[model samples]
Target: TEIFDGFSKTVSKCKFIPVVCGSSLENGGISNLLEIIAKSFPSYISKKHFKAISKQDNKEMQIEISENGNFCGFCFKTVLDQFNGKLSFIRVLNGEIKKDDEVLIVEKNNKFKVTKILQPFGNKIEEMEKGVTGDIIVLQKLDDISTTYTIGSKDISYTYAFDKLPQPVYSVAISAKDKNTEDKLISTLHKFSEEDPTLIVKYDPETKQNVISGMGELHLEVYFSKIRKQLKLEFETSIPRINYKETITKQVESRYKHKKQSGGHGQYGEVAIRVSPNKRGEGFKFVNSIVGGVIPKQYIPGVEKGLIEGLNNGVLGKFPIIDIIVELFDGSYHEVDSSEMSFKIAARQALKDAMTKGDPILLEPIMNLSVYAMDKYTGDIISDLNGKRGKILGMDPIPGGLTLIKAEVPHSELLRYATDLKSITQGTASFELEFSHYSPITGKLAEQVIEERKKFITAEEEE
Candidate 1:
């Protein structure tokens, strides 16, 4: 029972291949890789292990691979190249897929001709006719098809897809070195995002920065290297920022009015809103209170939208605003100029004002960390986690004398933990993060972060 509880799975697609290559450069060992790839791998048609039994005949039927074409492929990878455009890495699941052949993408509910079908001979691609079922073929120029999309002929029906990849645990903020590279960086990173589903790129409006997050610093570094190759663009990176959240401790109310008169119509909108702290993770809430048409029903969503956008104003300070309800209880609207924009802006300002008085505190992400380490470093690792405000749930020894440890630690503490752990345990320690509930920080530790925030803001303001 203990073994089952502490077990971790190691998955591999094809492990039978023998790897033998010399030199750290020139991309060698690839020759053996190809031989293994071509011969070691199984073909759907030739594989004799698969058998289907029929009840009436009590006989097994083996799907035969003949000259008859049934055109079926399972998507292996999705590539989004800006030049050649999107391509799908497909494995012929059933029949032969050839160049210039018409194929129906059943997943997309559309049909597209195979612009080109190339087989992987090592890394070099070779054009082939009707890649037999079992051959891995490159499906080019299929814009809509994604990874795992099963493409088949109208007559044949068989599906095969790969297992899902692991989730990304590391990420960081990224930006172009120059203004000219902004568009290029955006487009190139998006292509990379499509190629690897785990790689993510997000634009943070508060930070006004492009954040590129992936499995690790190396993962992001490789992307930067590719960006240099793809677009000839250079980049500047910063330490990954901590995802801090702000929450209020008590209920509070605030009101604001925006009225302007210039030439044509006047702008008038008033909002009286109450803010209350919700339980952690509940997120910001909005309520409407209009009895005598003080504010129109249609304008309510406009106000909510504005408040929602700016509710994270406190977010940059590493805090999340949650459980606060706002009401447009009292407000006057101008008949001529009262519009959604005016109300939205008024609502935004009101929320900002209320946030200041809400006594916000920062909350950091907690990770349920499971570490596999040798017994020699167990004491050191546990002590280190405890120093970072981590709580050890328990520890159990595994088959290899490596202890499986469960603990809850803050994300900030584990930024470079992978490297540190490998060093301490001599490449034997490994850990995975499962995001747990967040909690608040106290003492000088919290103060250090506050100072760091001020510096971050000052740097941004200069920008």
Candidate 2:
């Protein structure tokens, strides 16, 4: 009893977490840990109030954590059971809730009845009639309920603040092996994403592949393993291709005339455009500088549309073009032979002609990388990143003899970094990646990217 008192004082006064070590496989010391937690932890009533946002006035407020107040809680975790459907595990912060009570999903403003509340016991659960303050209860059949969602009684109109999810750093292109189960695979992946918001699944239109992204390789593999076991589905996964962009370096003026004379009314249109490099990341812009009705106003939209469409496939590697401005300064049209189609064709040709001479270059996505590893492995980490064309920003010695290494690396070079880092640090290091900006690639690297793009296009055409 004296030792327990000292430990509790240390925890409450110093805000320190007492570590309880035990072997889960052996089930040793488990009961003692549980007893300590139940006895030493402070009751919910002791926590005077919880911070929350009032939805009614969009202001910050506090909700008292007491059984006398209206029921309010937030979902901390979710589980999708094949037999029982979605189960939302909520930590009640205020008041008490009973079966058949209507509660509002604060964020969604939707009401749902408390159908069945259960207390989880390892792999099983036991039904409960009512849940009060500080109780962690699992509510079954809340299909739309997700993790971090705030729930409150009809009278309560406040939501607890939850931390935002981190951005996914690793990705893999996935495809169903059977092809017939593609829809099922996507639907199942979506359901899994709902259970864990960190897992993201989407289709990449540029690469024409379905991609699944998560925290790391292991994080993605766990979901894949679950899908394989639960649905008996076969799937293939590969490193996703980098989404490189194309841009020009110089300005050039070009013109194109489309004339086809075969029938009574032949198609005829001419376009003159000045293509100039815009500021980086400003995206594509179109300007019309025509006067005296050189090109009819009606056909101007067609010319703009043509230039925009032309950007989808740049002259260098067919990647989408960005940060370029196209100005329609001069053009001509025949009264009877000219049409929007003819102008569109001419405008597209003109842009293509200008791009080929404007010194086009490939731009690769740059990622801001932060690596956390032991100081002993810092040298190896720096050397490996330098070999991968990473620019080391700096390194700081953090607590626990760990170093935080920050760097900027190209996305293509990081496709397999998660696996490589594990091997390099023996699973003692971790890293985060976020897109920084697009940087131009030149010389052999640019040539290789263009060549690979050509091969991809040819293979796709053949298929």
Candidate 3:
């Protein structure tokens, strides 16, 4: 009986339990020494001998051991406690874990020492020194740990992959009411995103707002509401502006000379570059074709870097410039004043001039949407989608009188669509949206977008 209690204590310390059973008729009086050895099984034993333990054949019952040793646990959930700071809820899969053991979060390439392990007992938590396979324990001070991380021992070779968390589809542009709350709100949003993988926080340059994306509208509303109630933080949010892109339609050559003389060395550089339209989705490409040392190699990277950064704010509506190739063919540099800074300024000026002559056009993001609703609201859903420049692929019928409608709609049209769909379907419909590809905007719609963008920029400049 002492052996049984000792075995339990040892198992509790190691965070795992090994079951060793044998018939009384055979292997009679297996010593308590076996229990001491069981605590270190698979880890302490040689791989060859450990594998052999499972092959033992006997007339009576046999206790087999495994070789791979339990060393698997993933951080499934995280919570913030007023006293504890941060806690990671980990479920052990294959190996034992102890309070002082060092485990690697293979995904994050981070090593953390388990400060304190606690096992949940209903509403309260009890300190646990060790937990073997099949035991769930909570560890503190795992601030960087998240649902995507897999915790294992240092020697483990295999990396455990946690299930893919849900991706955020609906995004809202959020901003604090006052400047004082902005810093605190940003910090809290980062912590919220770390705690919940489904929550995403990003700053949108186009809209100039901090955007928080989540699985659905309700999911994001719950998070913002919780912040307002618990943290006494107040913020307002609206649908974000669509991030459009500008690309060229033809190849054009342009030249720019940047000469500025101040108190210090005068800046003087001349650059000639060719801009060409690339295939959709090819992104931006830079090539230095300078021969006979038209431009020094050292300054060539400056031109490229300048062009790349310059593309972030495009000519049309300040969107990113994409799907274009810029070639630096010829340039002149002044011996006394020419430097990387001068060449960079010349390159940006040349690019802007070339883009103006290269027939720049706007590209909008299209999203593939899947809508699930009852048959009664199918007509209304189709009509609404069509009005938003959606192209319906097809409609499939499912069981329970539900219809699945698939369509590709422009991203701008779907910003406030979640609420609209709910109203149209009377809360009986749900939908999902994912980015598909960039499509060209032309005619009156393109003109309207350009005008709005110019007006926005003018207002911002005045502010």
Residue 108, candidate 2: C-alpha displacement in angstroms: 4.0
- In model 2, the runs with Cα more than 4 Å from the true position are 1-5, 12-15, 51-71, 95-102, 109-118, 126-130, 153-159, 164-166, 257-270, 333-345
lDDT of 3 by residue, 1-463 (tens): 6765665666656767675566656764466546556644433222221111111231222212232474667688888777877878887766688877888876666788877889988667899788776678888877677765677787644444445565677888888988788989988888888788889998876667788888778988888888899899888887787788998899999999999999779998888998999888899999888999877888888898779878987787778899999988898888788899898888988898888898888999999999989999999999999999999999999999999999999999988887898799887888877889899999999889889888978998998
For model 2, state the Cα shift of residue 163 in Å: 3.9
lDDT by residue (tens digit), candidate 1, 88-207: 788775667766777777655678877677776754667877687667888767677877677777654434334657666666677777888788888878888878877888887645
The 10-residue segment of model 1 with minimum total lDDT is 3-12
Candidate 2 per-residue C-alpha lDDT over 63-160 given as tens digits, one digit per residue, 9 for 90 to 100: 77788888998899989887878889999988888999998998888999888889898989899999999899999988768888999898887889
- Give the TM-score of each candidate: 0.75, 0.87, 0.80
Best by TM-score: 2
Q: Pick the candidate with the highest lDDT.
A: 2
Each candidate structure's count of clashing pairs: 7, 0, 8
Task: Locate the minimum summed-lDDT window of 10 residues in model 3.
Answer: 47-56
